[model samples]
Target: MKLYYTPGACSLAVHIALCEAGLPFTLAKVDLATHTLAEAENGSTDFYAVSPRGYVPMLQLDDGSRHTEAASLLQYVADLAPAAALLPPAGTVARLEAVGWLTLVSTELHKVFSPWLWHKETAESTREACKAKVALRFAELDRHLATRDYLAGDRFGVADAYGFAIVNWATILRMPLNPYPALQAYLSRVAARPRVREALVAEGLARD
Candidate 1:
């Protein structure tokens, strides 16, 4: 499999998952500025051909099929290595809850922060609005995380990966994480994971 991604983008979640699952995959870095695979004077056209949407986190399977969406990609990678405990078993109540949190992270938290990160035109207004909304969601997760080391209880499931990937945006966007102590600790824990560290470095983020 080949995962096309931009460094430090949402695709880092899938990258971390693949590493944790012990999956062998090639990484194709995308230049988001040009929406292409290679960094060149003129961007490589190959990646855009594979994913016309021109987005990162496009997973090209062994069979040459492409899957988008970080939330769904999390499930796909988890199923690929069920023994790793990345996700609970399918069709069970526990698994259902895991999926619920994944969806929430994607739709509620991830999408809410998307607008502010990509533009400067209305970033201030959008960020102020999103700050209040994300704080509520962050507090909800903070309360839940305060009692557990990982999301979905003792295991580090897919939801935790998605959550960490989204919430880590606080640093890049200059959002305040100091107010949410539990959430702050949670990010630190996630960052300290070996696989996650590997992903962060691979995505050109700091090794620390």
Candidate 2:
């Protein structure tokens, strides 16, 4: 399989999962600012043809199929190496709970934070409103995290990876994580993981 991603985007979640799963895959860097894959030694448009959507986080499988969406991509990578515990066994209530949190992080938290960064017009009242909403959502995450080491349970799973990826946006957006100590601690814990650290470094987010 091959993964096409932009540095520091949500694709980092999928990259972290691939590392945790111990999967062998290649990576193509996308220049999202240009909406094209960076040139190979000779330069090319192959990746663009594969994903006309021109978005990062597109996973192309060996069978010539592609998977998109950070949440689904995380689950796909996790199931590849179930023994790694990226997620619990399927059909169990625990697994369902993990999926639920993944959905919340993707739609509620991730989508909510996106607008503030994409549109300059949102810099006024709109951005403040979104930030207020995010604060309430973060408080909920903080409360839940206060008692659990991970979003699903004591063990790290797919949801935590997705959550860490999206919530890390707080750093770039200046969203102020100080009020959500539990969530802040959770981010720190995930960041400390070797695989997560590897993803961060690979994405140029951290120095080797």
Candidate 3:
């Protein structure tokens, strides 16, 4: 499979999970500013041809089929590598609970940061409002992380991959994590994982 992504975007979640799962795949980097691939893996510079939504984390499978959406893709990758236990097995209560964590990461954290806080044209008041909202979510994460090393279960798993990608945005975007030491520590913990570190270095988000 070929995973199309923009460096340091939420797609990094899937990239890190794929690495941890020991999956074989290539990467196609998208220029989100242009929504074009520098070298299109699916034979089109126009990313819309490969993904009509013009989004990153579009996974083109070996059969030439494709999948999109990070939440769904995270679960898909987990199922493919069940031995890795990236996610709890499907159709179980454990799986449902884990999926709930992912949904919160997506709506509360990821959506809160994007389009508003990340865009310069957004009004200062709007950015402040978004940041305020994100802070509430951050506080919740800080409290939860205070008692656990990982978000989903006993080990670093799919939810950690997704949460790390979104929550690390606080660092990248210069939001203050100093007030949430537990969340900050959790970020550091996730970043130190070998596969997560490899993904980070590969995306140029960190030095090896």
Candidate 4:
């Protein structure tokens, strides 16, 4: 499998999931600035060929099929390594709950950060609104994580991986996390994982 990614983007979650699952995969770095794959043998920048929308975290499977979207990719990696228990088993309430958390992280948290942080042309009002919404989501997550170790439950699953990737945006945006100690602690916990650290270092987001 080959996982196309942009360092520290939402694709970080998928990278972390693959590592946690102990799956063998190659990394293809995407230069978001140029919307091209860096160091391609053919020197092709036509990332749209792999993903219609030209997004990161596009997983090319061994059979040459492709999968996109961070949330779906997370579950796909989990399903591929069921023995690793990266996610709850299929057809169970726990699994649904895990999906719920993943959805929240994607739609509610991840989307909120992208516009304000990535797009310089965003209106000031829109940026402020996005920050406000992010704060509300963080507050809710802080409360939920107050007594729990992970998003889905006591286990460190895919939901936690996704959440960590989104919430870590606070650091990059220079947004204060002091108000949400639990959330801050949650980030610290996930960052300390060996597999997560490996993914971070591989992506050049962290020191080796």
Best by lDDT: 4
Model 2 worst lDDT window (10 residues): 39-48
RMSD of 2: 1.8
Residue 19 lDDT in model 2? 88
How high is the lDDT of residue 143 in model 1?
A: 95
Across residues 36-117, which tens digit of lDDT does each residue of candidate 3 receive? 9889555679888778999888898999899899998998999899999998888999889899999998888888898787
Tens digit of per-residue lDDT, candidate 2, span 1-208: 9889888788888988898889998888988776766756245655656677768799989997987888889988999998898888899998899999999998898888875766787767778787888888899999999999999889988788788888988898777899999999999999999988998898899877
What are the lDDT figures for the candidates, one per model?
A: 0.86, 0.86, 0.90, 0.91
Off by over 4 Å in 1: 39-43
Worst 10 residues of 4 by lDDT: 40-49
lDDT of 1 by residue, 1-208 (tens): 9999888788988998999999999988888787766743244456667688878788999998988999999999999998998998988989988899999999889898886656778667777888889989999989999999887887887788889988988788888888889889989998888988988888879655
Clash count for candidate 1 is: 0
Q: How does residue 177 of candidate 4 score in lDDT? A: 96
TM-score of each: 0.93, 0.93, 0.95, 0.96
Give lDDT for model 3: 0.90
Shift in Å, residue 81, candidate 4: 0.7
Q: How close is candidate 3 to the true structure, as a TM-score?
A: 0.95
Determine which window of 10 residues in candidate 3 has minimal summed lDDT.
40-49
Clash totals, every prediction: 0, 0, 0, 0
With a 3 Å backbone cut-off (N, CA, C), the pairs that clash in candidate 1 are none
TM-score (C-alpha, index-matched) for candidate 1: 0.93
Which residues of candidate 4, in runs, are more than 4 Å off? 41-43
